[model samples]
Target: MSSSRGGVQPLMRAAELEKMSLEQLKAVKEQADIEVNLLQDSLNNIRTATGRLEVASTALHDLSLRPQGKKMLVPLTASLYVPGTLDDADNVLVDIGTGYFVEKTMAEGKDYCDRKINLLKSNFDQLIEVASKKKTVADEAGAILQAKLKQLSPSS
Candidate 1:
């Protein structure tokens, strides 16, 4: 039967799907699942990076608002805080990766965060596009398997 929403359905018949071995169908499903999972992991990484960029952007903005020479609690470690004063609110230390830091003006730091956030979001969008294609393949394979199963049933 032709589906109301489409002009033509898939050409593969139930009989053709039934001819395919179960092992092959299962393999296709497994491979598709693995690819989708990897893409999801990458998306998670992008999300984490986005959060970090946002926090950095906010910190820079707050620093710019603070009066010069204002004493503040500086984080030396995750749990350790050191007494420090905001000597130059216009300057900031930006980590450029591999434990290397660059001293930049407040505006520069914000710009850096904006660039990183945009890059991460771009990666996230690309991953989503790829994952959607993988999911479509996985779904089609699943449909074939279901069709074959239905053919094997006595009710069919």
Candidate 2:
């Protein structure tokens, strides 16, 4: 039995070896808990980053593929105007591709895509940072447990 700090008997086997093994196990368990917490935080960060990327991707697609009303020109038919309509003939308009408005709209879309890409990259960076730290902590904790278990083994 272990020496009691008070007058009461310690709630453990009195053997020294058993006490040492119990202490080591307790330490290992604490380390395991810490490692688990770190890993969970890392996973949360990665999930957040993935969600942000998906949202950005969806927004980009929506903006780029948005339908601009019907582009077809109205059919040219004599019924569209009076048979002797000389004023309509003088006021007809033709389609000229690639105007200033189209260029401005395309430029806006490009800017939006670039911004979303940068945001996604930032989120991924944060995820990597957390994951790397978590991996390092988990590796160290695992090594400590392995070493402790080896020491406790009878064949060691």
Candidate 3:
């Protein structure tokens, strides 16, 4: 009987669902559907972030192995790259967030990426659990609604 995100009411028992009017059941189903969709979007974003962090971590490791002044192609945009040389492989710029970048040593940069990846993974797991519960609620509501409609049909 625990509360769900966005102040959604707890999942009701089948008896309670059976007592509700069609409109009320529909409202419950719609709300649960919306919440589940939102959670799914969040989960996707977290997954993308984790993937980017993993890439960053791998790049950092690769860079650490290269000597200073190594030739490289710096990406200016998705389709554009500029030739450049690694001036200081030991120090790299890390984008913390919100247009803020910080200079960190290679080890620190790798650590930061690992930490962010772990954090995003943790959030992803928790959100998955919530999304599953919300989906169950929506499915149950839809099932009950269908049953009610069937009972009221002329063929019944």
Candidate 4:
């Protein structure tokens, strides 16, 4: 049967919903319960990840500002052709495998810096939109679940 409003079925009242067959009502209750639990878990995960992202952003800022000796700073300077540049030059090491200038182990520092920037942007967007939506869904699901539970136990 076609519904009148926006080609969709009208929402039912809590009292009206309790009149459905046991099997149909049971399925709806199960779905609502699952949605509530899933939304709660997702919110927890997003919170934890957001905290980590903040820490990572702070660390990246510190690293970017921190002074570095010759060797630790070479990876950030993209100009490979600059010869006899004395700034932080003593720390440069010749790679045994490739005979090219390589910063010992601090190369990963650049990677981490890039990762931190991207993560902050992406996660912030997700937390604002997806996480917020999930929270709304969980709230609605919680209401549906509560109504179903009360239907099953009318006196409570």
Candidate 5:
């Protein structure tokens, strides 16, 4: 659950929505749209994190296969790579987030990536459920608003 949505009120029921003024319905619809967008953004971020973790896991597997003193191009930046030789294939530095890195054995690094990927996947599944509910609420509110508008126009 996202802390950002802690202050948001629950969506009104369909029966209650019918009794709201035009302006009130519009407000509810807008709020629902905003909430849905936020949840979608959260889902996207989780997916990206999962992808990065999977890549790291693959890299760890590849590194474990290489012999010591193997020559390689170590990336200093996206486009900048410097020639280097493998120092310790058994041990690698793992980024634990918040600008921190911890040295761990290759097996341990792979395990960390797997754990993080699983955690992110679980969170993504939960967020998808929440986002689906929010979409339903938004759709219902929009339908009600359109009906109200049609009632006012009468010529359609």
Candidate 6:
């Protein structure tokens, strides 16, 4: 919500809300819609991250059971696969982010994958929590819009 003087306020008391014009009410509704959309986007991102983490965890488990120097078709993309053979089975490349890589033992790589999964799960949970709160705010804004519209209705 914004005050008459143009500064934005996060929440408006009931009395302050009484001062809002129809245009301001509409603007508030718009802002709430925007917030909901942004939250939805964040939720989608969390879903994607969670899915990738699940796949990583599974891949790590499968790798731990494979024989050393096992031949496998490595995925380059959704449709592309390249013939590849594992090296030591004891040594693996771990990505630390930003295209950087580090060498680690297989056990260490698996542990790293587990830690990454846990961190992503924690983050995903937080996003869901925040999205739930924003949903409540969006619902309230919708109710406010409805009330304001009723007050301005011809039957009012």
- The sequence of per-residue lDDT tens digits that candidate 2 reaches over residues 1-156 is 212322112122224223345455455345544645765676576566556546644644544454444232333452463323122211223222254222234345445546655765676676566545544544544455566678879992
Instruction: Put the candidates in lDDT order, highest first.
Output: 3, 5, 1, 6, 4, 2
Give TM-scores for every candidate, taking all chains together and pairing residue i with residue i.
0.81, 0.38, 0.92, 0.40, 0.90, 0.78
List model 6 lDDT by residue over 65-156, tens digit each.
88977999888777999999876667777778799999988788878878877887787788677556555555655577688888778982
lDDT of 3 by residue, 36-140 (tens): 999999999999889889988998999999998899998776689999999999899998999899999999999999999999999999999988888888888
Clashes of 3: 0
Tens-place lDDT per residue, model 4, 1-156, is 113422212233455444655555455545444544654576577567556656544644555455543234324343454323234422334232355555633345445445655765676566456435434443444466567667779583
Q: What does candidate 5's lDDT look like per residue over 59-135, in tens digits?
A: 89988999999999987776899999999999999999998999999989999999999999999999888778777
Task: Count clashing residue pairs per candidate.
Answer: 0, 1, 0, 1, 0, 0
Residue 130 Cα positional deviation in candidate 2, in Å, after optimal superposition: 1.1
Q: Model 1 over residues 34-147: C-alpha lDDT tens digits?
A: 777887999998899899889989989888999998999998976899999989988889999899999998999999999999999988998898788767766777888887
Please give the ranking of all candidate structures by TM-score, highest first, separated by commas: 3, 5, 1, 6, 4, 2
Q: Is candidate 4 or candidate 5 better by lDDT?
A: 5
lDDT of each structure? 0.79, 0.46, 0.87, 0.48, 0.84, 0.70
State the TM-score for model 3.
0.92
Looking at model 3, the pairs that clash are none
On lDDT, who's better, 5 or 6?
A: 5
Specify the highest-TM-score model's number. Answer: 3
Error of 3 at 104 (Å): 0.6
Give the least accurate 10-residue stretch of model 6, judged by summed lDDT.
5-14
CA error at residue 114 for candidate 4, angstroms: 12
Looking at model 5, which ten-residue stretch has the lowest summed lDDT? Answer: 1-10
